[model samples]
Each structure stands twice: as C-alpha cells, then as structure tokens.
Target chain A: MSGIVATIIAKYNYWIYICLMMIGLYAMITKRNLIKKIVGMNIFQTAIILFYVSIGAKRGGTIPIIEHAHGGQSHAVEAVHYINPLPHVLMLTAIVVAVATLGVALALAIRIYNRYRTLEEDEILSRIRGS
Target chain B: MKKLGLLLVILSGALLLYATVDFPLWGDPSSPASLHVSPRYIEKTMEETSVPNIVTAVLADYRGFDTMFETTVIFGAGVVCFLLLRVLGGEEGDHYYRHLPTGVTIHVKGAKGKSLSGEFERIDMLWTPYDLVIKTACRIMIPFIQIYALYVIAHGHHSPGGGFQGGVILGASVILLAISQNLRTALRRIGEKTVGILCAIGVFIYAGTGALCLALGRNFLDYAALASVLGTDPVTARSHGILIVETGVGIAVMATMIWIYNNVSSAGRYDEGL
Candidate 1:
C-alpha cells in the first residue's frame, strides 16, 4: 500500500491538476453567484499554471542557469542538469493573460452590478430578461 | 432551470473529456510541440539574437507580428469601451448622486451637479477623511510607479520580463491610481485625450520601427539596419529597437487599460466625474 501510494504520488500530479480544473469549471457553470464564477475562473487559470510549471520541472534537476561566464556553446554538458525553461516562460505569459482577463471580467461585473443592483447571477439574468 | 443547466453542463463536460483523449499527455517529451519550433528556438536564439533570453527573442523578433496584433486587441477593447460609455461633451452639468445602504456612495460633482446642491450635501459626509488619505497616497505613488514601469520595460531584455509583462505592470499602476484617487484626478494626470493619442503613437512606434527596417533594405523587423544609429552591430541595433518599441507598447497598453477600466466602471455615466 505504501509502495502504491509512492507510485501514485510520483505519477499523478497531472490528474490532480485536471481534477482541479474540472472542479473549477463545474463551479463556474453551476454556481449562481457572479463572484463565485470569478473565483472559479481563478481556480481554472491556476490549474493551468500548475500544469505548465509541472511540465517545466525535471526530477532532481537544478535551475536553468549557466554557472560560469565561460559555459561554452554546447547542448551537451556535464554535471549541470536543468529543468526546461520553455514552460516556465509560457507560464509567465499565461499569468499576465489571466490577470488581464480578470481585470476586464471584474470591470464587467461592476457594470452589471450597477445596472441590475445585484450580483446574484440569477437575479441579474431575471432583471435582464425583464428589461 | 437548475436541472437543465446541470444537464447541459454535464454534456459539455463529457464532450470536453472526449476531446482530451486525443490530446497530448502533460509534459510528454515526444509531444509535437516539443519537437517543433520551440526546441530550435531554444537552441539557436541566443547565438542568433545575442540576447540571453529566448522568450524575449520570440516575443520581440521571431513572432513580433503577433505582439503587434495583441496590442491592437487591447486598443480595440479600449475603443469599444469608449464608444459604448462616452458621455458627449457640453451636457456635463446634469448629474445625480445616490447613497446606497451598502455604504458605496456615488458622488457626481461637476458643472452638471451645480443645481443639485441639496443632494450633494447629503452625501458629503460619506466622502470622509479616509477617502482623502487614500487619494493622497495615490497622488504620491503615481510618478514613482510610472518610473518603476519604465525600469521594468528597459530591463526586460536582461531578465525574466518583456513588453507585455512590463505593459501590464504599468497598466496596473495606473489602475491603482485611478481606484485610490478619484477617476478625474487620475484622468487629469493622464487624460483620455492623451491616452487616445498615446495609444496610436505606441502602435506607430512599434510598426514604424518595423517599417524603418523595410525602408532601410531589410525584412520587416530586421533591426540590423538601425546599426548605424544604435552602434555598428546588428545585435545592439536589435536590442535598441526592441527596447524602444517595448516602451511604446507599455505606454499604449497602460493607457488603454486605464481608459477601458474607467469607461466600464462608469457604465456610460461619465457625468458623475467618477
């Protein structure tokens, strides 16, 4: 059982990330509060960040920095294993995208609140339909 | 309604699940994405561009056209907000205030509100000392924040940053100022007119730089042509060109974001003076 647990831990971070992503999506779809929907969106984006960061990770690898000034031009090197830098870079872009999206979404939410005088998703919907 | 919503959601989830079966596994070393341009980019970018950061090379040079469109997308959002929410000039003296029970007060103080003295005084107590403190802090920080933004823009080439990241930081600084101080004060510091002008100017700086390369007898964004001005090296010229354009993008993005936020938050009621 302990060995099985270790195997699962070693291999299943992706599954956990996927689960969180789905849960967030489910909340966004089913929750009747606008703020909850925003929270769900945050969770979904965070899950994507986790997935990207995980991809960049290499087991027992060091940070992706060349040590000396003379670390010459060779893809093959010794005693300097490093994690992939590409996913980390991609994750940085993703973070900026998420923040921008959040800003726009929140601004819309504020506008909706002003127009309908409520943040409950159902209330806003009914008010719109009534209008 | 709940049942239908749940059922539709479940069906969508099922469809998403089906789609995922064909998707590449997370972090697969053999994935097509890893095999393609990315690996080549990683390997050759430093030698080709003489910039240590591969992401910066990809963003500023290799895929610069995409970055241009990304800025345009932001500009479009700003224009849409402005068109949808702008109150025409000369009717600025028609304003009203409402003090909701939730403690969120709306104060419309301007030429429009000159006739509504009674209503204005009624909500005067709501604009307390705390509001003044927050406003003062925003005033003091705006310049420093903008300078820091410029630093981020300039230093992006050397570090884990770039045009988009620096642009967003600058945008957030302006947004913070707008939120803490009143929108009018923030606008006076960087007005809609200036923002609109700067937004165009920013895009022009980016596109114009690329166009300059074309006129100088090279491909679009071949910064090598600017070698005479920037120094006698293609690397230095490219570095100089990228920094300049990134500053342009940062300015445009920051202004547009603040403009959009102001318009959307005001919800077409600019007479309120935010």
Candidate 2:
C-alpha cells in the first residue's frame, strides 16, 4: 500500500494533466455554443502543451542554456544537469499551431454568425431544418 | 447528439487517465525524454555552432526544415483568412461628419462629401475621446517594441528567443498601431498587396537559401556549402546560415500574423473592430 501511494505521488503531474484534459473534453463535448466549443479546443491544446512541456522537466536540472565554458569545449556535461529540450522545441511549434487554429476557427465562426445570425448549435440546426 | 458526445468524452477521459499510469515520474532525471536525443543536442550544440542557446540552434539550424514549414503554415493561415472573407471595392456605409468650427453636421452617402477624401475619413469611425492617451502611449511604445523584437532575433544565438518569437513580437507592434489608431493607418503603411508579397518573400528567402546550397553542390539545406561565400569556415557558415534563415522566419511570421489579424478582425472589410 505504501509503495502504491509513493508511485502515485511520484506521478501526480500526469493526474493534473488528465484532469485538465477531461475538463477540455467535457467542455468541447457538452458546450452548445460554437464559441464555447472553440474555447474548449483551445483549452485542450493548452493541456497538450502542458503535458509535453512537463515531460522535459528534471528534478535537479538547470535551464537548457549552458552557462560555463564546458561551453564549446567538451562533452563532459551530464544529461541530469539539464532539462530535456526536444519536447520544449516541439511544443513551441505546437503553440504556434494552436494560435493559428484559434484564429482560423474564430474567423470561420464569424462567417457563420454573419450568415446564420446565431451561434447556438441547436438554433442553427433548427433554422437550417426550417429553411 | 449530446448523449453520444458525453459518452465519447467520458470514455476518452477514462482511457487517458488509465494511460497516464504507465508514464514516467515527474522531473525524473532518468526519464526517456531526457535520455534520448536531447542530451546529444545539448552536448554538441555549442561545439558545432558556437551558439550559446541550444534551443535556438536546434530550432534554426538542426531543425531548419521544421521551422521553414512552420513559417509556411502561418503564412497559409493568413492567406486562408483573406481568401475566405475579403470583399473588395465596397463603399463605406452612410456617414455624417460634424464640422468643428460651424457645429454643422454634413450628412454624406457612401462617405463622399466635399473634400471628403481627406477630412471625412478623420470621423469615419467612432472612438472614445480619451483614446488620445492610449494612442500617444502606443506611439511611444511601438518603436521600442520593434527594436526589442530585432534584438531578440539578432541575439537568438545568445538568448532564449528566435525568429518565430521575434516575428510574433514584431507583428504585435503593428497590431497595436492598428488598434490604437485605425486599420487604414496600418493599411496605408503596408498595403494589402505588400503584405501578401512580403509573406511570400519571407518563405522564399528561407527556401532560396536552401536551394542556393543545393546549387552550390551540396545537399539541400546544407548550410556548410556556403562557406566560401560567407567567408567563414564550414562550422561558422552553418551558424551564419541559421541566422539568415531565422531572419526569413521572423519576417514571414511577422507579416503573416499582421495580415491574418487585419483580415480576421475586420472580417476582410478593413472596417471598425477591436
């Protein structure tokens, strides 16, 4: 029981991300407003970003920037000294993609609003059926 | 429909939580992400490129192709926004401008009145009277923002920023100008055609550099090929190449962001919006 508790405590960050992901999922699934759906999508993207960034962390690691003269000279530096950077790099691109997606989604929403004069999913469907 | 969505959401959430149990501990030094290629990148980055910033080196030099395509994605978003919403040659709606001296309101259809081209546009949009304070602050701040953006781009080798970040910052300054003043002011400084062309040119510069390397009898995107031209050794040539391509990315990101913001916020009308 103590070992199980220790394991859970060690991996608690994953639980945080899981909760966040569930919040986003619930919002995206249950929200009737188109804009709310987009907000949920943004939240989902943020959770993914957080999950990836968290993967790069190290308990005793410094920032990825190497300050001393091991600088350009030697490969003596250890991996445990610096946090993983690949995920950080990948997540940067993911962030840009998220922003672009948000912008495009909002633009599309505006176009729909202009045409249908409503943003609620049920109302839009009803209007479409009536038409 | 809602019931189905709820079912899927709950299933996915449960699956995700179940999967998290198999993951590594938080901030563990022995985690797989840290054990793999990241250590190699950290070890070799400064030695190979002399760039102190590992992320910038990896982003601009090691993963140039990724950054190149990433820049294109933003440019495409800008183009897509314009294509979806642009309505051309439309007249401004009915307007009435107050003559300050005579306190007379001259009503005009399609915003065309006597000497309307210059004077009428001054009152074309509504803004709070206290906007002057915000406008003055923005005017004072824009230059510094632009300078800092350049610094971020130029000093990427030493610091934490690179082309995409600097470009976004640069774009935000133009966006600030538009917000404080008007879209017309921004459109005047950088016309639609210019923005379109500049975005394309930014991508072209990155591709062209890679293509230039190919023409010089090296593999595509092999920056070391331009050693003689840059008057540096192979290692330094790669560093210079990274900087050059990073500049391209910056320009592309900046142009694309401004272009997208202009189109999306205005709904392609270049009319009033926040």
TM-score for chain A in each prediction: 0.85, 0.87
What digit string (tens of lDDT, one per residue) describes model 1 on residues B1-274? Answer: 5576567656765675565656455445555555554566555655566555656666777777766666666776677667656665655542434444444455565645254433332223223423787778877887788777778788777666667667777877877876785555567777778888887888778889889899989898888888866666887677677787787788778777777777765564442234
In every candidate, how many clashes are there? Answer: 3, 0
What TM-score does candidate 1 get on C-alpha atoms?
0.75
- Could you tell me the lDDT of residue B241 within candidate 2? 90
Residue B109, candidate 2: how far off, in angstroms?
1.9
Q: Give candidate 2 regions above 4 Å deviation.
A: A1-9, A69-75, B1-3, B92-106, B110-115, B122-130
Evaluated with DockQ, which candidate comes out highest? 2
Go through the candidates in order and give each one's C-alpha lDDT: 0.67, 0.82
By TM-score, who's the top model here? 2
lDDT, candidate 2, B4-85, per-residue tens: 8878877887898888777888888887888888899888877788776778778877887787787778888888888887
Q: Chain B alone, TM-score of each model?
A: 0.80, 0.90
Residues A57-100, model 1: lDDT tens digits: 55554544423313565453222144456666666556656655
